[model samples]
Target chain A: MTAQQTLWSLKAGERCEIIGYDTTLAEAYRIRLMEFGFHPGERVTCLQAPAFGAPKVYQVSATVFSLDDDVAAYVQVRLEPRDA
Target chain B: MSKVILVGSPNSGKSMLFNRLTGLNQKVANFPGITVDVGTGRIQAMPERTLMDFPGTYSLQPISAEEKLAVGYFERALQDPEVDHVLCVIDATRLEKSLLFTLQVIRDCQRFGKPVTVLANMIDVLDNHGLELDVDGLAQTLQTPVVPLSGRSGKGVDELLASLRNPVMPDTNGAFANAPDALLRGEAHALSRRFGPGGELLVRGQARLDSFFLHSVTGGISFFLIMYLLFQSIFTWAAPVMDAVESSLGWMADALVPLLGNQVARDFTADALFGGVGAFLVFVPQIFVLTFIIGLLEDSGYMARAALICHKPLRLFGLTGKSFIPMLSGVACAIPAIYAARAIDSPRKRLLTYMAIPLMPCSARLPVYTLLIAAFIPAETALGGLIGWQGLAMFGIYFFGMFIGLLIAGLVSRTAEDRYTDLPFVLELPPYRMPGFKPLLRNAWNRSRHFVTKAGKVIFAVTMLIWILGYFPNYGADLGESWLGQVGHWVEPLFRPLGLDWRYGVAIFTSFAAREVFVGTLGTIFGIEGADENMVPLVDHIHASGLALGSGLALLVFFAISLQCVSTLAILAKESQSRSLTLKMFIGYFLLAYVAAVAVYQLTNALVA
Candidate 1:
């Protein structure tokens, strides 16, 4: 089963495909996210969730990017199958 | 001469490629804005061709101040008649993101009718991982010459040089230049998916390291240890060289002072040249050691991870993770740190960073701290000699200064009017690599030379003036009767509450020119005072004078808090563009330093009593 959720919902080592950004996300941030290759259909993997509420690291479109939880919450994604 | 603009995203090895092409030791930091000034150098292969290394940027749209500066200069250079070509450097391993920026550059170059070449950097990493990128396909798709090269390994650089001889313009029709950015973004994504390296090779390697570096337990432990080591190394590693410089200066004074026939000339040579400027020269090695360690952190890409770790805590102080770079750079010197502040996206955070930078325990403060600590703090070791008391004292004062800076930032950011909203904390974590020692050593040497040639002149002039003023009339017989003594006594009351006499009062005033001048001024004063006929080090002179420990500690506190350099004030005025802000900071810090020094002085004396 496929579930749609915010990118922040993905735990460490989880995989997802970009769907779109939330409508509530500001235009400036949306454009920047898109410029960073977070467009629809892009694949992302959660590489790390640093302790004490530090920004999490994610692999977006083959490049690593660190985003705070608030910004990550705006990126909508669909869960991808886990590797064996 | 034909000019080429070198542009790329931050951490794409663009600066390294510039070094490879031009053979210049232009700094390449893991973070952005290492090229705050446009560095121009002739290409090593074709001396007639000049390359301009612009500051790195993520997008042509320009978000941060540095990006805006880069994009602005890039656009203006495209219009300049002398400009010939635009070379866009990209990391082949992270092809998709690099292509996102490359696509924008290509689109912009098309609009400007300028020829563009795509230099795909860092293929050595790809080769090690056995990943592949289709250079020809990428070139065919973009209609620009794609030269894949390893900036670190110098592979494919000859081909890049050859390609530069006959640069090609985009063969696209007029319609391509008008494509919307959104459409170009989609096209870049599609192109990378087809031609970029396949699978998860790059991210996996970075992730494995991040797991250890970003872990709650290990990361925290390593961070403190690394920071402690940085301060400790500055004192311990540089001590032997410092002593060598001291003894050599002593030998030179011994040989040179006797040769002078005239008594006045003998006193001037012994007091002003050797005693004053010579004392300042002993601390130069510490600046070299500081620069080397910081460069190691910067080149190895640990600076970015440190920034990431500092982000959450730094934000509470009304600064971003980005401010960490400038603040850390401030530990070396504040002038470049002010320039490095350009990378910070928000004006509000940038201003707060400026406020904190002057408070960082910079190398200029090193001489005074060493002098005072040697005079007051004992030379003892603990943990079976693993840690020296002097290094610990250095670390304590550094931490104390930084803590006070953060407190001031927190207070100011809370009370000040919010003009610009805060930008999100987005910092690029470049893949960790072993730092190239050649560039680090070269940069350290250059920094030491720069400190000497620039601040050395000022210290020399100040030393000469102090020597003349103290030597004249009574001719060093009675320092209390000298001209400088009279001037110093006039200001002595202002410093008396902090337990400083007139000689120190004079040195404190002279130090405003440069913080290192404090030691030189004191050296000259004591030399005129005839402290020792055999020329003891400044520490011994301070000890022989019987300066109270409380007064010594007070001086350390004062130097730590005060903003002493005139160049820093000048740059603060130019960067902040507000004379009032610079003046307010100068006055405010002085007042705060005075109050704190007096309190420390009283408290120390009370405890001792």
Candidate 2:
């Protein structure tokens, strides 16, 4: 999946596992993602992606963080199915 | 006596280690030509030995101004005759980067012929991560002894002290003895290249975490929730402790009043000394709690993350993300918060941050806000009870300060034409570890001690001065009838539109010394003799007093943004080294406060009536 497509596709509060990055756009993606603790095999839960399309808040481990929309568009994630 | 200097990166638990060694016998004084205080403490390792805790710094080649002070000290120490041993403290988890500085110090020692040792602190954290260092190998490589110690646990501290007592000379001719000139030149390159694989994985792990927390939508909501919890904790948890302090002061005042018997002495002791200053002392619990949380954020490395997250929003006001740390700290006390701005590198950005910092509703303003908000605004939630309106109002006050700060920063940048130099925004997000007890307690105690000692002296004198002014001339009559009363009355007209009486005028005037004095001043004016029962519920007090709602709201708005901290301004002046800039800041904030208060009062009164 494309980086931008992966981010835009996630619903708020949805859990997703990061399998790996596509190395084609890796360097720019790596530097941007490093600041937020995103990496291979890490799971991320999106807390907020506002309707007006602003930056989103996320929970990785114990620490809570905020990232702008432009920066958030660089990450790819495998969406997890919701439990009924 | 040989002096041992303890040095490390900022927030590397150096101060906690210092406290462990020396206990309460430490003295913190400002380094010459800088506002950063050099904490000196005598640790008697032997009958005839002492150790000194040098202020923390990131590098020998200074990037920020405070780090430059450390560099300058090293340069000066080379020529000074009284110097002795150097104890370099390194964070075990981040040993690779810290070792770079360690290497620099070793190189300096090799050149200058000074004795040196390395203490690998936070070893416990390293062991937990399943990482083991070859200390003996490191020791041999650097030609200096390496002792693994935990500052929090007191483990290996005595052994480290013993090593310091019986100093070992480093081999000047060793392989690591020579300055790694190439290594120093290509430090960042070396960091990424040597540790790239593992570091990349770590970076990726951290990025995954950031993607979740730093999301714009969720980040903002989480930020507000965190802040709400902080405020609620300060208000609810600190109340009982505050009461205990108030009750103790009441007991002391009662005990002393009978012993003195003289009315002048009695009144001075009860009203001037205890009533004025004692009232603020009760809030120390809240202040400590706030400081502890802030210190935890800083120590755990989450604070920098918070700063980075908020950077863009703050930058809209022409501030860097780093400015948020100091501004967040300003909520606790502006004195340290202003000093905390030392972390921000750009002169213009630092000054702008400092100028707007006091606008953050500090603990000193809490009593006043609580009094006003309780009296005026009913406890109602905003947006379908997702959050309390009172909490939102409190949040709005913070948002207002940040807004004004950004507005002022933007205007200043536009008018001054000073280029905003952006420093590389690199902060280490150390793995989350439970902040250890000794370090946490020691930090809280030392900070409280600093607050009680340095700021306390000024607060005590100011509180006394306010008491003497408001108490005497109006001796038998109401304060409105005294000489100070008359002066307040003349100023009263200026504030009348905002709904403040002469009594309120006197309180506001006194509050400039310290904002918490507003509580004491009101208590004294209302003839509440003791500190314990000084604050009547805000609604009851205001309703009974017949203050127009518009006036109360206006007064609330005024206190919200007013620069009532003289100590904060003094620190800002010292930090920036410009009296004119300090004066400009003071005038600008005060003028903005007055104008905003008047506008709010007028608009609200017109709308309601």
Candidate 3:
């Protein structure tokens, strides 16, 4: 699925599993995500989406990180439905 | 001696590596036209060596003037025959992005024909992540000798040092063998094209981090909490050490007093030297502790997180996310904070941030705040032992600094020319890694030494000057009859409504050198010898002198907001490159201080009546 489909379509507080990174953007960013343990198969939780569609705050493991809309738009994840 | 310059992104552990190479031989100097510190140190690498820890930057490309200086230095060093090696430090955990800069360095080395070495720092962190690098593969790929060393654990330090001692030539062929597609094709570029090829990488790194960290709200909150913890830690962990310093000063004063038989000499020794200088000295422990923690956060790459976090709030103040790094540094000392503002691209905004930074209640303000708050506000527990009102009051004063900072920033932003649309908040959140102790200790020691050496000299000289002023005209005859006493009396009418005596006025004036001097100034004015607990005696003196509570409250408010330190002002002037801005900052702050104090005192008096 496209990055926009995964991040933008997901509701706030939704949990998702990282599928992989879309490497079309800068390699530095892709590597930075990898270094932060945001690899495929890791669970990620959408914490907050700022008003007027600002940056999104996500909880990856115990650490809280904020992603700008552009970066958020490049991260690909599979949304975990509420039940599972 | 051959000189090697260590350069890398912020939090890449470059300083840590620099310490490993240089030990305690490092000194911090300002790059011309900017406030960022360039740490230089001499290392004895098998008969001859010197290493300079350049200010951390994302790329060689210049975005702001500071990056330009760093890139400029890198190029100048390349051309200078005195410089022999360029140690390109990379955070191995974030090697992909780091390699991008490394490739640029290789390109620079090619252009300048300077020998270079790749240091894959934080190898220990990679190990912890269950990741291992093919150092040999990376070295071959980059055509450079890669030394996998952890600056924290001392692991591979000897090997790294050995490499420095016996330098190796960078393999020209492998240098750009593994360059990313964009860099190789020259497709992606940084905003620093204004400076030509020299600044491209630097601008790219900054742009990348700026996009993520500057505009994000969550990033802002996270930044606030990190800074809040940093400030909170200074108050919490440093207390015991600060108390020890206070006790030591008391001991020294007691010991010195008996040796000096003359009353004037005795009082000067106890009150002026020990009392004035000693009070400020007590904060050394807190300063060292805070500096150490900040160094760790910076070395570990968390400081970038802090900058990113505060970006949103800082932008409101006409500062970029990068401005928060310097402002956070300002908590320790405004000198470095002003320099840290070099990362901000906009000249006007940088000047405003630099001017307003000193207003933040730095560690120097702690002694003043502690003394005043102790005298005026009763320490009361509130709401099921969840909080101490005294602690809350202290926090409120700190909160007041931030509140005023934002208000001033917002006001300034309205009047100042909008240099550019707000820069994107893009920050690469570097992976969390453990900081090594040796580098941490070295940094702490170096900073503590600098504070004691530089700030201490200024404070010592200023204290002596103020002491001379307050001491002469025979205040010993009867404090009421002294020159300082007469001066205080002259000013007393202005302050009488606030319940302050001439002594309080003198103390407030002396505090302009450094805030903690107020404690000693009060001690000298009151002629109370060997009182480590100066607040009680001070309060008693004020109460017996018949000053109203309204005046006490007014003094508290004045101390809370007044721009009291000359060093802070000097730093502002140096950073902003505008004497008028510094003067305006002082005037604006002092005016606000007077207004706030007067209003608080009058209102409190009215409410009490």
lDDT of prediction 1: 0.80
* Candidate 3 regions with alpha-carbon error over 4 angstroms: A1-84, B122-233, B261-263, B296-402, B417-423, B489-504, B514-553, B566-583, B598-609
The TM-score leader among the candidates is 1
RMSD of each: 5.3, 7.8, 8.4
Higher DockQ: candidate 1 or 3? 1
Please report the TM-score between candidate 2 and the true structure: 0.73
Q: Residue A77 deviation, candidate 3, in Å?
A: 14
Model 3 per-residue lDDT tens digits across residues B344-373: 655666766765677666777776677667
Clashes of 2: 33
Task: Report the lDDT tens digits of candidate 1 across residue range A1-84.
Answer: 665598888888899999998898878778778878888888888888888788888888678888886688899998888982
- Over B1-609, each residue of candidate 2 has an lDDT whose tens digit, in order, gives 556677876656687788778764677666555456666777844535455677665567664555567677876765455667888887665554465577778778767677788888877755655556567767766678888888888788987977876778656675555545445534422342343222233334565555555556665677678767766666677778988998999899999887996877888898777776676577567667766766676666566666666666676676767788678767766766775686675556787787668777787777787777767777887777998867777777767776776677777766766443433334444554456555555666666665665556666777676666666675635776666676787889878878888888877887787776677667656766542234564345557778887887787788888888655665566666667777887777778888999999999989998
Q: lDDT of each prediction vs. the true structure? A: 0.80, 0.67, 0.67
Number of the top lDDT candidate: 1
The worst-scoring run of ten residues by lDDT in candidate 1 chain B lies at: B27-36
Ranked by lDDT, the better of candidates 1 and 2 is 1
